[model samples]
Target: MHDITHRNRAESPSSKTLFKATAIALVVGAGLLVTTVLPAEYGIDPTGVGGYLGLTQLNAIAPQETAEPVEDPMISDAQLASLLNPVWKSSAPLRNDTLTITLGPNEGAEIKAQMQEGDRFMFKWEAQGPVNFDMHGERPNAGDEFTSYWTGRNKTNANGAFQAPFEGVHGWYWHNGGAQPVTVTVTTTGFYEKLYKL
Candidate 1:
């Protein structure tokens, strides 16, 4: 029987060095992953209850304030009539619908006169003194008779002409400024001639 002596080979120097380097790298990598990478990707909240941070809520906005405007009161029938056909006549009887206006020294005012019932009229003006006249409505056609006789020198003369622009009962209001009392007679001659012959 022959006895054989076999020697166990020692581990190579490069292999021992490689094993130590791999163990050190793995330890350092695990420490970095726990300290930095995990928290940033999936956030770690100290409260342990998870929720979105830096987000806006729908309830944060306040409700808008709204307002409504006020309206004017409706006028009465008598008041409306008075405004539409205003007259200041201090009478001496007989009115086929009479309206009078007394003008004080250099006083100027507008009296809105309307003939709501009739649609075509010949308006006549009889006054005494200096009067500035401007008429509005369907101006009367040519040769349409509308007589105006005043107490002054310009009375009988057809000093002015107003053609009715629209078909409607129309009348005139005048302002007289003279040293004496002036009487004005206004008359409507056409369209159900409700003689406003004041």
Candidate 2:
């Protein structure tokens, strides 16, 4: 209460006094920045005072980065190849093809690729809408005889790799049961003779 009476009557500091305090503060700050902060934080010692004060040793307590690989050690070419793609030997020539088909409501279509036995292939198919599909292969010289590998109902997409068991025409048969037309786009890359719509 007694100090509150002089709140409005307080004598403001003179410019000269303010300047002197600011100069002292600035000098102390610069000295600390050069001697303590730089050395302790970044191991950068401009003045030797920081090293003598053990502040520079504080920077060494932190971890140091290295160029060495942690998870990746020196590996053989076979190991590197397996890590990349792990290619399996196939007798069939490498062939890649993209096939697209549009099916109306209650309509079904078959897309097939001719491959020999033991021939491998990777296929991915995407449908604009839900569909029923059967991934199967037909045996050579067999009429209406087939082997079912995979089947799904109401699937939008599929990704798989197949090794022909006893190859003739291996492929997918997609049926659209929806009201609207669905466009199915399939991409295949592997050891197959050719891709065509049946």
Candidate 3:
């Protein structure tokens, strides 16, 4: 038979000690929330420590500039019609052309269509291997000046439509960069006068 009343009971921490521990925990949690969580999450730097640590920039918004609007000059209907008309009128019938050319390693070639401003055509081309290409145009008397519409590198195929911006030659230039030969085949249809190799 054991004397149960004489046994020692488990002791609890003093009220003062418990209160001190809880206060310390609350202080540490509040400090962490103010210094780290606020600045990093919301860009709110209250104590300046977040700014010193560069955490305030995490949510910073960039400054933006306001652009001034410009007004366009209106043109008369007759002027607009004159500007939209084609430079040359062809009495001959339209034609379609397909061209295939082989380019040696590091070699280049070009093909042009005789087109007037507002003339349009659909074109598609493919290379047997990867190549670089540029679609551009030039006026006959413009003295070496040219306008580039698009350019691409390391491509195998492309298809698109184009409307001439001036009375000129519009076309594509392809450059083969591989060690082996590459063949480029192009098919076009529309109002162009002719397709010729350049």
Candidate 4:
């Protein structure tokens, strides 16, 4: 039988040597703290080397991220509101329509514009005499199912804007309520496909 002995011959480091190595490491850590960590994380570039190396930019960016941007005073309130609260955009072109309708006593008529969902329109109408009116919308092919926006009795005029909640025909139904006939003229400008008597 043969016996083999293997052992590590290197001596354990001396306390003096270990202390010297620890001091060297401490010096390097302090150097890095002054040159990099202080400027990059806290904007403290006492040695100016961190600023020269562009490490201060990191701390500069932190404040900018926490700060709210200053809004320009030249912007109008409406412009600012539009920026903060965006509006719907449609592919439809801008158009205008002026419709003059005459209704005999106790008679009714409708004038509407075909609008897709999110379309907007402005309308103004005046009647020679007071008439009852209803502003409503109808979805395509949805017979008898409609959304009424406004209604009034014996109104001589009306003016307002509308945003379509769904794809539909939207407009006014005015009924002559007086003993005599009434003539109503309606003007509309907006992003609608067509306007016609229905």
Candidate order (lDDT): 2, 4, 3, 1
Model 3 per-residue lDDT tens digits across residues 1-198: 977787655455778888999999999999988898899889888998888888888878665777765475678788888998846565534778899999999999999999878888889999999999999999989888899999999999999998899999999999999999999999998888899998
Model 1 regions lying over 4 Å from their true place: 1-97, 109-118, 138-170, 179-181, 192-198
Where model 4 places Cα greater than 4 Å from the true spot, the runs are 1-88
Error of 2 at 104 (Å): 0.7
Clashing residue pairs for model 2: none
Off by over 4 Å in 3: 1-92
| Residue 120 lDDT (model 2) | 82
Question: Per-prediction TM-score, please?
Answer: 0.29, 0.56, 0.55, 0.58
Candidate 4 whole-model C-alpha lDDT, 0 to 1 = 0.91
**Cα lDDT of model 1 overall?**
0.44
- What's the residue-level lDDT of 196 in candidate 4? 92
Give the CA lDDT, 0 to 100, for residue 51 in model 4: 97
lDDT: which is higher, 1 or 2? 2
Clashes of 4: 0
